[model samples]
Target: MNIDKITRTNPENMPAPVGQYTHITRIPRNAELFVTSGQIGADHNGLFPESLNEQVTNTFNNIKTVLESERLDAEHIIKVNVWATEKIDWDFLYAEWGQLFSTDYPAMTIGYITALGLPEIKIEIELWAAKV
Candidate 1:
């Protein structure tokens, strides 16, 4: 895929995105879309970290692993949905996010929730991707 086949736009009619993401991602026709189960703060070894920062980091690492397993990278990402049990460390998360997406940001939605699938899981991220 050339990557240009995916289009992202932040409409002038609406306020700018609150974070480092676009409002819309238009996928080309005939593109293949992939969806993943919510990725939690668990490592490949099934170890869950104790701290929020470590959990968040592990979550991102898990996301990357899932993407790679599907033969996709951040470029193939169309949307990212994040759910957190507590306030996120934006500086830390943005750093990880930047490393993953670089400048090719995709549409995203984030929410602060009360709990997740597990007690130790501080955050979960679900990804939507496409390839043309």
Candidate 2:
């Protein structure tokens, strides 16, 4: 599924993003937008893992479930925000992300914070999606 009307821009005047993200994402006025609450790194039963990699995987998995519940796919996603309590394994995280977004990268920002909602929660992800 693809929303061709959505626009993703990376201004040439600006430096390229260090990772897989655009500088801006423009959604059409006719599209329906969806905003999700930050999803934490926990399993289906709400169990958090100890390792950062496991937490990252769980976070993305949770986001996938949210999208599925909404009957939406990665093509509808336009923005993503990530928060982490510890240093991330970029390669592992990106691989997990690739399973969802593929080449349809979105505008994104990631922050390394001191903590999340729970002491065991190591990562969180928020998403904004639009369907035309």
Candidate 3:
């Protein structure tokens, strides 16, 4: 979807998304789009954080690095998919989410999985963004 033409909505008539996502994202024609593969909480040297909070922090930081490399930021994000192996801390996650997106939250989906690429990895995040 084209970033410039993207429209995020949560119809008042419908139930809000269970988490931090919007219910709908409309993308206009001819918009440039970028999709990132799921990012894990691994640093440049492949080190992973043990705590869920630290892992989540690293994952988002990595996402920021990727977006910046493409001349984009959180404002350009339309959707996000998150996966985690451990029980989620909703309050902690939402707090971080608030820090990242502010009020411009995007459509998102989160899942709990049994495992990730590596045993120590606790979280993964992928995103879609656009620029007109």
Give each model's whole-structure lDDT: 0.90, 0.90, 0.85
What's model 3's lDDT at 20? 75
lDDT of model number 2: 0.90
Which candidate would rank higher by lDDT, 2 or 3? 2
Error of 1 at 129 (Å): 0.2
- Per-residue lDDT, model 2, residue 125, is 92
Tens digits of per-residue lDDT for model 3, 1-132: 335467889999998777778888777677788999998888878799789888887887888889999998877898999999999788988887777787767898888999998899899999999886
TM-score-better candidate, 2 vs 3: 2
Superposed on all Cα atoms, the candidates' RMSDs to the truth, in angstroms, are 2.5, 2.8, 2.3
Look at candidate 2 and tell me the lDDT of residue 37: 98
Q: How many clashes show up per model?
A: 0, 0, 2
Q: In angstroms, give how far residue 11 of model 1 lies from its true place.
A: 0.8
Model 2 superposed RMSD (Cα): 2.8
Worst window of 10 by summed lDDT in candidate 3: 1-10
Query: Any residue pairs clashing in model 1, and if so which?
Result: none
Question: Using Cα atoms with residue i matched to residue i, what is each candidate's TM-score against the true structure?
Answer: 0.94, 0.94, 0.91
Better of 1 and 2 by TM-score: 2
